[model samples]
Target: RVRSASYGGTQMRYRLQAGATELHAAAPAMHAHAPGNEVTLALPPERLWILPVEQ
Candidate 1:
């Protein structure tokens, strides 16, 4: 999970991997002054893969 703050709002990126495949997903652009202070995305287990291991 990676979070970035911008002038307008914040952006989050989540990447998941399964076996040799990887899945990258992120939330929609959330504008400032929005209602919620937190945003969440529910992803399937198979679709969520952790970062690749570096050698």
Candidate 2:
């Protein structure tokens, strides 16, 4: 469920929940992020980064 969102000029902040987890994501403002609205997340390979965890 989507909690809330704040729209900026070219980006927006979104708060969402999935079970016991809550996520705050930032992305381009190409769509409306109204409160209580459901949203889909897509991360392409070009936008993905892999980092090694320190032991």
TM-scores, all candidates, are: 0.29, 0.64
What CA RMSD would candidate 2 show?
3.5
- Can you write out model 2's per-residue Cα lDDT over 1-55, one digit (the tens) per residue? 6788899789988898867977777778987678888777776879776667669
- The positional error of residue 39 in candidate 2, measured at the CA in angstroms, is 1.9
Write down the lDDT of every candidate, Cα atoms only: 0.46, 0.79
Model 2, which residues run further than 4 Å from truth? 43-55
* TM-score: model 1 vs. ground truth: 0.29
How many pairs of residues collide in each model? 3, 0
Best by lDDT, which number? Answer: 2
